[model samples]
Target: MSQHRKIYLASKSPRRRELLRQVGIDFEVLLLRDAPPRGPEVTEIVLPGELPEAYVARVTQEKAQAAWDAVLARRLFTLPVLAADTTVVIAQEILGKPANRDEAISMLSKLAGNTHQVLTSIAIKYQHQLLQCTQKSEVTFAPLSDSQIAAYCDSAEPYDKAGGYGIQGMAARFISHINGSYSGIMGLPLYETTDLLARLDPH
Candidate 1:
């Protein structure tokens, strides 16, 4: 695909927008919402006994499909729709976005002094083709004090991010290191995403 080709981003995540801009990919934000009866549902609920990898991939595909449905329903301009999902996993337990301050603190506490996997799945849909890929990054967090966790949680940055933290935000100080794509941990993997788009228009 041409790097300049405009696509639709089916997410409101600023991180994703920033990453796309960094790579010089032009895209428009395509927000998803239920359209009453028969509308596409984009719930984050994990299926029973779903593994972390499978969970992220499934959600990303669903999000891309829903975005396409919305575009068709609204008769919007036809463009390739991109969607992604991210999740943090530790000891095989998937930690989604925290619901409250306490949950954020709990998640941070568990993450302190430990290594966790950040799984990100990116999907794109155009015409009759759907392409997808999953990226995994291992993040190691330094030992954090109770005071530190509380202060970070109080910043209100953990509420909307997976694993109760954003690697590009204040939580950067907590991450000792990462073994995979940094952008993936931030919610989008630039390398994988670009590659997938390239596949969509292989010249």
Candidate 2:
């Protein structure tokens, strides 16, 4: 809960950084050397019959492990590395970030008037110990009109986030209900994150 014990956050997500900052957890962003391709993203393809939970957990572990190795490779000293991965699933299908305006509109259209799952998996590695957990939240979206979808897509917020929307952004207007951790839906679950850090002190 103090800045005295800082960790390295292995992510570029502003939302995750802000969440950690708000909770008084001091952290520095850790980037892979030469901007290497994220292990999961390098494939951009999920395995056959892989469930949402498995996919997210695997990605989080890969990210955390990669960061840990990077710390040694870069000789960045001995600090814990925290990483997370979030994904959206509807009707058993994973909704990825849209590559074009059309896909964004499609993702939003399917999410409207439906309940979808947002799963975020967090991983923390310190020395030889590694800890990981997953948070699953169901988000119910209100029925949206074509104009509303178009307006949101035009805002350009759907291009970089999973499931084509950020709950903390304008997309909040489209959410009717959420049955899980808000912070988890945003990107990071503070309760789980704090617990992991306490159990495995970053020092």
Candidate 3:
């Protein structure tokens, strides 16, 4: 198999792009039809009784599969596809991206003064082989006030990010500490991602 110098990233997140760049990985953004229930996009809706780890891994695999399908359907040059998903969980409940400012505030309210799990799953699809891994990080928040949550929600960071917050943004003030891959909590785990790429590429 020919080694790929660049992979196709199956996500629209700028944070993911930035993370990939930080580790000196070359990747092209592969856009997928993400139109909710109307498009062929992968649905993130958690299945009944699905564990948090399983949910993240499933979504990442689906995204990687979707990207591979797009390449074949569109006749694009074949390259390894990399996809990732991140979600915040507190009290065993998975918290996805907030739909509105009120929801964002509410998500943060529940997260304040508590330690939560940040689950990020990564998948790489090359040829008929698929490799995947899930990174779990623990993040603790330094008790936030209603005003702080309101002010943070007023910005544009929370709407597109998981758990209604971005660890690399102003939300850093809200996080007292993190006990795992920082990039993982940010949406992509650099160490795990680099390892997968090395395995995919044949030097």
By summed lDDT, which 10 consecutive residues of candidate 1 come out lowest?
Answer: 32-41
* Tens digit per residue, CA lDDT, model 3, 1-203: 22577889999999999998997888999999877657767889999999999999999999999899989999998889999999899999999999999999999999999999999999999878788999999999999889999999999989998899999999998888889999999999999998888777443
Please write out the lDDT profile of model 1 over residues 1-203, one tens digit for every residue.
77438899999899999999999999999998756676546988899999999999999999999999989999998899999999999999999999999999999999999999999999999889899999999999999999999999999799999999999999999888899999999999999999999889522
Write the residue-wise lDDT of candidate 2 on 33-70 in tens digits. Answer: 43345333223468899998999998888889889988
lDDT for 12 in candidate 2 is 86
- Candidate 3 or 1, higher lDDT: 1
Total backbone clashes of model 1?
0
Alpha carbon lDDT of residue 154, candidate 2?
97
CA error at residue 170 for candidate 3, angstroms: 0.3
Better of 2 and 3 by lDDT: 3
> What ranking emerges by TM-score with the best candidate at the front?
3, 1, 2
With a 3 Å backbone cut-off (N, CA, C), the pairs that clash in candidate 3 are none
Instruction: Give me the runs in candidate 1 sitting further than 4 Å from their true place.
Output: 34-40
Top candidate (TM-score): 3
lDDT, candidate 1, equals 0.93
Measured against the true structure, the TM-scores of the candidates, in listed sequence, are 0.95, 0.92, 0.95
Please give the lDDT score at residue 19 for candidate 3: 91
